[model samples]
Target chain A: MSADSPAGTHPDPTLTSLDIGHPVYAALLDPDTAFWALVDKTRVADTLAGGPLRDAYRQHADACRRELHALRFELKPSGVYLNPTERCNLNCRYCYLPESQRRSGGHMSVDQLLASLSRLRDYFRSIMPEGGRPRAIFHGAEPLMNRDAVFAAIDAFAGDFIFGLQTNGTLLDDGAVSFLTARNVSIGLSLDGPSAGITDATRHTWSSRSVHNRVLAAMNRLRGYGSWSVITTCTTENLPYLTAMVELFHAREVPTCMLNAVRCTLAGARDVKPDDGAMSRAFFAALDRTHELYRDGGRKLVVANFANILIAILAPTARRLMCDISPCGAGRAFFALAADGNLYPCSEFIGLPRFKGGHLLADGGIEAALTSDAFRSVIGRNVDAFSPCDQCVIRHFCGSPCPAEAHEMNGGMTSTGVFCAFYREQVNYALRLIADGKADDYLWDGWDDGTETLIDLAH
Target chain B: MTQTVLTKPQTQRASSPSPAVAPAIAVRKTCNPDGVGLSHYVLMDKKVAR
Candidate 1:
């Protein structure tokens, strides 16, 4: 990174990984790519390529590109979301999608769902970028509650797009797992943490008893089927138990874990505001502890989402990360078709009034909805409002604000996200970890990039 | 053109109002790429946002 580079200039995420543990001064002054690009002409190549550090350098470069466009996506086709049944067996207190609406029969018929999906498939085909596949996500009170409709829609739109769903793991029977696995559909289950006390505090059945056993059973079933992993929601109650959460995954031998701060959306849990300061402490502590446990226990790093982010920023060989960086991926790459045939930017606005664009059955169907002022305005506004974001150093790497969250939190596209504080906290923690003497031992040393201390930027 | 007469020397310099008044907003310096050890330095700002 050039020191005098302007504020808006995006830093190469790849350059970030050269050395994890070395002092920044060492990394900045490394022989090959010295801070001032100052070195004797004869020694540069040997410094970067002739040592065991070569591989680290390459990995750092790869990781940077992976993170540079983490949220970069080209709109394929607009997709539709069908809220088949507004019913969930588990009654999680912090349930983002409230059950009240569903219990009142906020369900769609099979015919209605299929029709909406067909319209979405046609729309995606019309505007798809060459060979890309349009995608759709099944989110609801519990998408699995209406299995018949889901299967029918999947079968109907098999070749048109990719399908994914988010569930709470109560109804993940063997048959359902087999069906989704056979279809190659990806699934994300909601589980807070290990044990009945932790998991049951929020997620529970109608009887108000612990659903931990059931959820664990479902996880075990999915693991046997070789498909799903748990998406843990980080909250104040569970912040202290992060190490426990990671250890649980290691115990279960789960492949991966994604930790998302508890969202306080309209449908989100009540009274749960993200404590950025505390969250940062918990996250760093957990990372350090987990790293040690992995080294000692010979267990795979199950919680690598943040580490992957670091890798994306620092390593050169990592794959590109995917996310809806900006206000949301609306008409450009994706759009959500509501259960009532209304189009939305995403499923986060299924019941919210602001995102409801137009009815597919009423107007000229999906075509008009795609071009509706409401729909276009939402997308246009999201893209146009790029002020605070444009000048940030981590612009490219940090994707834009989440549209749904923006709408829900700040009441507009331009509002700073509530999660901004948390992000700042995380960045600070990463910088501090680098400053402390532990950077070399825990991060940079022996992380071979192919040559002598490949990432020894301070060489 | 008439030359302006020199003004009398004042004991105190021209007084400017202090910046820290009203509903003071708390400001904290958390660790970033620079500065001291990673910890919060809390201080109240005189100029409030509201």
Candidate 2:
């Protein structure tokens, strides 16, 4: 079939050979005609089938393939989520951490910490062509529970690596703030919202103490310290307060906020997981409010959802991180180093044996574990191989089929999760923004006035 | 400036005229998964919106 052929016409042999499905074919068949011009199928096929444009397309495809492979092998981790201790002060209802693991007080010894950092440094230096500077992110049931280990790791690797900490914020005392600020360690505080009624409902201490005042006080104290970001996990309980959450962050002058949909996991409590439709509505509603704040309210609250959409739409080629890519970056660009010296592909795989790569002390250590068949299997699973997502027009842009979410929702790695609809809506919203010439409105930073130009809205 | 709440349905608008320079092919860079330093990747020159 030719490019001009109507729907249901015999499939283009070239596209059929390339395994291009109907949805992608329909996107290409758009009346814009520029789609074909950009793809230059005749050129691509001729190049593939041995013709004049062969070398150029071959070279481009080869480069993309090589980069993809390197992402799995050579690219050093941009950040490592180090679970310094499994101990947490709060028992969040929506937390996915297994109860057993949460009770255990396992902490990484200084020796173990040194060994892990050494392994990461060697791996990063060997694979990174431009000398990768990986950051050490301290995560936990509560990282602050083992503050000494965190400080030790920071002191040990301070000059060589950047440091970040994710905490409940209630434990962030004045001394903690001083230490973190002195070392320039960025902190991400887990806060549901500003109201004690909303935040204390789920995020409370083990003794059932209300943590709202403590957390808010910490937020106030850390305002001028290094960098501060808020991570709010959206559950049905806090769904009604989503807008309020953004407003609170803006009011605090928080630089960045990540509103994450709580992943439904078998190992965690059965708190309500919002349906795709509900999440889509809540996400867009929050996004609209955030945009209003930035464009009119003069608040610099940068919601990661809107920022990610903008990046996906405006700089598709520049998205090198796994979280934004097809196969999901789980094992490729990011990994989770458990406290017990075991390595997992992502944070969600901490307690799960099936996803364990190996130990940090293995002969080849991180490198051997990452290149192992187990890790490769996780990284190799791409959106192109998964259903629905395989035919998605926004597959290249929307970070879908997250390996951890897939396992949590579908009990497997290759399946798309409940968030597919929400992701599709987000991409659609981003496309609309580009088409409306309001792409600049999505710019949070990094560009001077009038520097960014919207080239085209592809989808 | 008053904050205008977005209540209208978000629909695809007509495509604008293409830029004189076609979008450049971006080789993905290693980025922080948390998006802390992502602004550095934002293009200052011509950029594709698609």
Best by TM-score: 2
How well does model 2 score by local distance difference test?
Answer: 0.60
Q: After superposition, how far is residue A98 of candidate 1 from its true place, in Å?
A: 4.3
Docking class of 1: incorrect
Off by over 4 Å in 2: A1-76, A267-270, A447-459, B1-50
lDDT of 1 by residue, B1-50 (tens): 11111122122223468422111010111111110000000101111111
DockQ value for model 1: 0.01
Error of 2 at A213 (Å): 1.6
Off by over 4 Å in 1: A1-22, A25-81, A129-131, A224-226, A267-270, A297-299, A302-308, A311-324, A361-367, A370-373, A376-391, A428-459, B1-50
* lDDT leader: 2
Tens digits of lDDT, candidate 1, A61-169: 4333332222232233334455667677666666655566655545677888887777666666676656756556676678888888988888888887677666777
